[model samples]
Target: MNRKGYYSIQMQAVCDNTRKIRDLYVGYPGAVHDSRVFRNLPLCNSLEDKCGRYYLLGDSGYPLKTKLLTPFKDSRQLNYNIKLAKSRYVIEHYFGILKQKFRQLFHIKLRNITFIIHFIRAACVLHNAAIDDEFQLNENIDMVNEVLPPEQDLDFVDEEEDRDARRVRDDIVNDLRM
Candidate 1:
């Protein structure tokens, strides 16, 4: 249980530029830190092999790795941060779309954790299928007024930044400046 006195599950997902979920990891308790949950994900183990020349964008809660790029804490790289934020919007938008389609995700009432995990995975798969089929939602449905759950606490202990990842980030920032 989290400090908020509610049981929760932590879910992690990786989406492509098209807003389709490429990978997902869930079933972690809500009390677990974001970094810890990410590290335990199967995708984290094969990230290097899965993404050869590409890097995944992550928020500050995650450690900067060769395959995963987190924003620099320093404010000098404003342009780089801005560009990264724009690119990162795809994943955020995917979550919004997922919740909009599967309202059960907003407050899943299933008592079985395993079942909840399966249900979430099924929703993701169906979401991808819907995208492939070019399914459109009703225009009359109010998308702006949907109330979402409160954001989870994301503060985590800073992991040691990989020197190679730092160098890679620096190169990208320099390239952005040119």
Candidate 2:
């Protein structure tokens, strides 16, 4: 329950990890799965849409691919992360600064899902503004075309976790109805 007995919402953000502005999304309580956010976040969609080779830096939350790079979690098979170390680190370091700026953002305390969405949008918009006066984005941005291991060969073990995650997401949303 929130300060008003309503379940608060959580906002998830995905960025290049070094850029001033991040692609953001607002989700309900208990919706912490990275795949969901990755699938739904408009920012990722927009960025990925732009033509040319674009590499999205992210953490363990989002799915791995040639375009969207993340740190090496395991050494199984030929992982693209082997050559992606430099570019991925940029996002990691930026995330640290983002968290420092918005401490309460990690635990957004709000009821209305719409308001929660707006709160995140507003934060991102401000960050976007800050970037205008700050260093230019993609200044040292790394752009490498490290091919991905065959999709069929790479392992993904989130089905079980996703099932439990969906249950919790449903519960939280249902609880809000009351």
Candidate 3:
């Protein structure tokens, strides 16, 4: 059982606009916060060196970093938030498609965390292969019904915002306004 009082495994993945998984990190207990899990990822450690000019769009649960841009919480930046959400919708859609195709992911009966992790990875690999084959999903499939964890914890507060990250986000907001 996790902090949310349920049995769950934390899986972190990054998918491209093409709906292909680019990076995957799994096996963290559900009790862990997304920000903490991301902070521990090897990808997070080397993101600056690897991404160069690219920036990853993350929800407010993640800390704003040079390579990872998160949405601003204030209502004043609604436009920026909307644009970011639209761009980040791909990952959410990908997860929905994955769960719909692999129904077992909804409720894995496995008890061993290691086995569960491997199982999830195998599913991801198969998902990529399906994408490679250009398999089309059922047109009627409803991706919106997929249950996702809450984006922000009402009780949790983030630390001080990074100056550089805030500047980058503000610049994007300004661009949107222009």
Task: Output the number of the TM-score-best candidate.
Answer: 3
| The best candidate in terms of lDDT | 3
Q: How much is 143 displaced in model 1, in angstroms?
A: 16
The runs of at least 3 residues in candidate 3 whose Cα sits more than 4 Å from the true structure, single-residue gaps closed, are: 2-6, 138-161
**Sorted by lDDT, highest first, which candidate order results?**
3, 1, 2
lDDT per residue (tens digit) for residues 124-177 in model 1: 999999878988654332222222222333454334547877888988888888
For TM-score, candidate 2 versus 3, the one ahead is: 3
Q: Give the per-residue lDDT of model 2 (tens digit) for 1-178.
A: 6465546455565555436544556665644456565555665546546414655655555654434545445554233354454455555555555555667667677756787778767777766677776745443434544533322212344576445544543443355456
Quote each prediction's TM-score.
0.83, 0.52, 0.84
Q: Each prediction's Cα lDDT score?
A: 0.77, 0.54, 0.80
List the candidate numbers ranked by TM-score, top first. Answer: 3, 1, 2
TM-score of candidate 1 relative to the true fold: 0.83
The ten-residue window of minimal lDDT in model 1 covers: 141-150
Clashing pairs in 2: 17-91
